[model samples]
Target chain A: MSTSHLHPFDAALALASSAAGLYTGHTSPAYWNMVGPFGGITAATLLQAVMQHPDRLGEPLSLTVNYAGALAEGPFTLQATPVRTNRSTQHWTLSILQPDAEGAPVVTTTATAVTAARRETWGVGDMPMPSVPAPAQCKRITPAFRSEWLQRYEMRPVSGALPEQWDGSGDTSLSQLWLRDAPERPLDFCALAAMADIFFPRVWLRRARQVPAGTVSITVYFHAGSDLLATTGSGYLLGQARAQEFRNGFFDQTAQLWNEAGTMLATSHQVVYFKE
Target chain B: MSTSHLHPFDAALALASSAAGLYTGHTSPAYWNMVGPFGGITAATLLQAVMQHPDRLGEPLSLTVNYAGALAEGPFTLQATPVRTNRSTQHWTLSILQPDAEGAPVVTTTATAVTAARRETWGVGDMPMPSVPAPAQCKRITPAFRSEWLQRYEMRPVSGALPEQWDGSGDTSLSQLWLRDAPERPLDFCALAAMADIFFPRVWLRRARQVPAGTVSITVYFHAGSDLLATTGSGYLLGQARAQEFRNGFFDQTAQLWNEAGTMLATSHQVVYFKE
Candidate 1:
């Protein structure tokens, strides 16, 4: 009997059929070029596949991955797999694969993820999900600046792009226009994780304004799993942004996540490395 | 020149002295009896002395301690040493230590840290810090019924404590609270990081009354440095509490940190396992 239901495992990499959802994957200008960097959407989609769906096979999800190596602005495929699916928890590995000049593939990452247990004595009650205007009533932000790849996915920078914004000092914070699974497609949690990564540190720092780079780690926490298409907004709500360790080209900063209604969502922290 | 400059690296233990001011230590009933746990605060203080005070002739702090296979709590000590200091950046390591049962010494942790580099560029600027009063001035909300540990920390729950009525379906959600550096002690990014681990999650899950013990990973992002003592009633704000994943006897959540001015200071994500 072919089971239509995904196994308790194999859920981390919930496959996506299109990019019309909240965190959709888009191809880049230099798609065939293996040396170019991966677009934000690609990163988001990979994350969604790895973190959100790993447990479909009936297991828990647990894993971590670091960029062992990268060719700035490259093309790659993100593949997620279930490493171990147990009754208590499931573990998974998500890999970013770059196709060689010959169309052969090279692996870039493998993170281990696990699911934690729940406590019998529970406390922090849930914050009600903000009463969001139905997506149909929400406005959409336009992608001010576009890349060959960014064009495939929709993103609205909360602030209009700045010209000569590169030295890292003016408008040091960043807020993005609300864009999720596009109108036609829905994104998974792994994909959402990837998309949220774009929401951290201060994206404005990258508008050709700051020192090359002072970053190393980027971390994200998930609150409610969102269906990419169902979550929509034209404008964006900016949370908190902070810079702590910025010595040299390696720095760590944090930003808080909030909904359009101003309800706090999640907090994001990461280390960024500027290519000086 | 026999001169010393405090580094921006965060220390897990509250600072005893700083050019800013001295922060006296106090033992709260929360972890009162666990002060002597392996590699607890005792060791961290010695490490702090060597790292923070230049006049003290101490070898670089590095020691290994055994877990002895049991869970333990603090008074956790954070000791730091500058691995390298420069105008652009400084690298340091902080160790969390504890004393053994026989009063013997043991080392718990050695974490790498780096200070942020000064820059000329400004992309996005500062988020509005709250105009709220200092933490000490904030209204202290003590539930008619409260936990000893919660009291030791002096939490001013902005939304008030968990309600007395409960029907049993766990509804872990978001909570806002004012946290003062208790025992009249001040804390830096590192010390605050550890303290953050102590509460927020429990508060967000207020529906669950039991203490949580099952923890997998605790990731903290320090935005800038903060001395908790100088923080008045509004000094420290728990912006948002998020429950990312919760299953079995474990859960993972993230909390945003802000100064009284409402400046985003840091973000922390933790994986906890409540075995009891």
Candidate 2:
């Protein structure tokens, strides 16, 4: 397909290899958040660099990304290094850099990823997918916020949602919703990584106050492979997220994503920084 | 206290600074596992390097460690680098290296940590500590295995015990227990990090088979700071762990640690590799 005809998700994740283990990418206005590009898109783009590397070993098993600082809107450079490669697994360290006003490259993000050649074995899903209304039955939510990233996905809330009053009367941080790409892109590892961060900050829901918050670090464990993602193509995923504790200007939320077939696709946990 | 009089946990975590951001440490026989030292102690020791670093910005906010390979019994070198330091937050990258048979240093583990100068803010805990008997009321477990690490911690299981029969008829992977250092060491961040990994591989509990399994990557999010840990003192921590999904020779477990007073201390998640 022509570059212009490609889906927004694909175009946003496009990367060019300038040198070995080095990539240059641009920020997509389509996925812009309040401050910068969506954190999910940035995470997926970083994973894309490793996935595109010739030296990469099998598929992604786990990924951890830490946002050191918000990226300014512009082009950025990414470096992915394979620190250790074992017989069945490979470990990588990655970073994204953008030139500051002084025209010097500055690190804005850091990440570590583990990829492995997984083999079939005994498997089970202990966290069963909760029964909820089908996506077609639930009303799609259109957030009133101006974040461009929120408009790129179709969200249908099943439980916890954004507070209507913002009066600090929230009782819980748990949020459940059916979500998928707005333009309906097929499922893939990069897309799955992005989808894992679809949930908004849990603190906003827990406190019913619009506190300033952003993810400091996020870790995602992939339970599905390429074949599984293909089988779940273009389908709505049920996502559930909840904060365990919010203390000392920080909180953590754990989330699980399951496909229409009830297969658990991924589980993610993140620590967020919040200002009162 | 003299070196000889130090607690085993302290002795195991002792580090000698060889240079800036470089530390030399030895494995303690008290915490040895099947092939090497327990993963918990190794994780705790890695965190110690940053904690003791002169350039550290603040307390740990999050830590993710990837186990590339097992450490050989003996001495190892650790290098911690402050990749990005902001006004209130600092990001670090760390690795542990051990000499191979060829007398060349090789990387065996890699980690990333975030430390921040936290401030008081709105706080809440959604995951309440489950009701269970006090530590004195529960009987301690004595496993048939001969791993030295098991003897270092006093574990009182409240549920999800190891299978008595290996007939492949296992069920849930949830385990709740009261844990504390057997020698009665006070609680700290390092101790809490180690306790996060105290639960055995959840697969063994989910399935009735003793399979070969090890943690591939683990991430711990700290909710309590020095003050909270000090308040916890030498008291037992009630830990709960459960597997969300087990598939394709890999599974992830989520855990929470709470002090006797029902104060949530930390939450941890890990992805484990298993062989059929």
Specify the highest-lDDT model's number: 2
Q: What is the DockQ (computed on Cα atoms) for candidate 1? A: 0.09
Per-prediction interface RMSD in Å: 8.5, 0.7
Q: Which stretches of candidate 1 lie over 4 Å from their true place?
A: A1-36, A39-87, A90-112, A116-146, A155-186, A198-215, A222-276, B1-159, B162-186, B200-217, B226-254, B258-264, B271-276
Tally clashing residue pairs in candidate 1: 152
Error of 1 at B242 (Å): 6.2
Compared with the true structure, all predictions reach lDDT values of 0.42, 0.93
User: What would the per-residue lDDT of candidate 1 be over residues B1-276, giving only the tens digit for each residue?
Assistant: 111232212223335654321223323234332322212233334334444555333222111111112224534444555434444444343444456688654544323344444343332224443344455665776634344434445566654345455544445555557765445345443344444554444432444444434334455544543232245232455554556444345555656666666555555566555543
Q: Worst ten-residue run, lDDT, model 1 chain A?
A: A17-26
**Residue range A168-249, candidate 1, lDDT tens digits:** 4444444434444333244344443444455433444534343334233344444433421136332343334444433223
Per-residue C-alpha lDDT of model 2 across residues A154-207, encoded as one tens digit per residue = 999999978889998999999999999998999999999999998889999999
The CAPRI category of model 2 is high
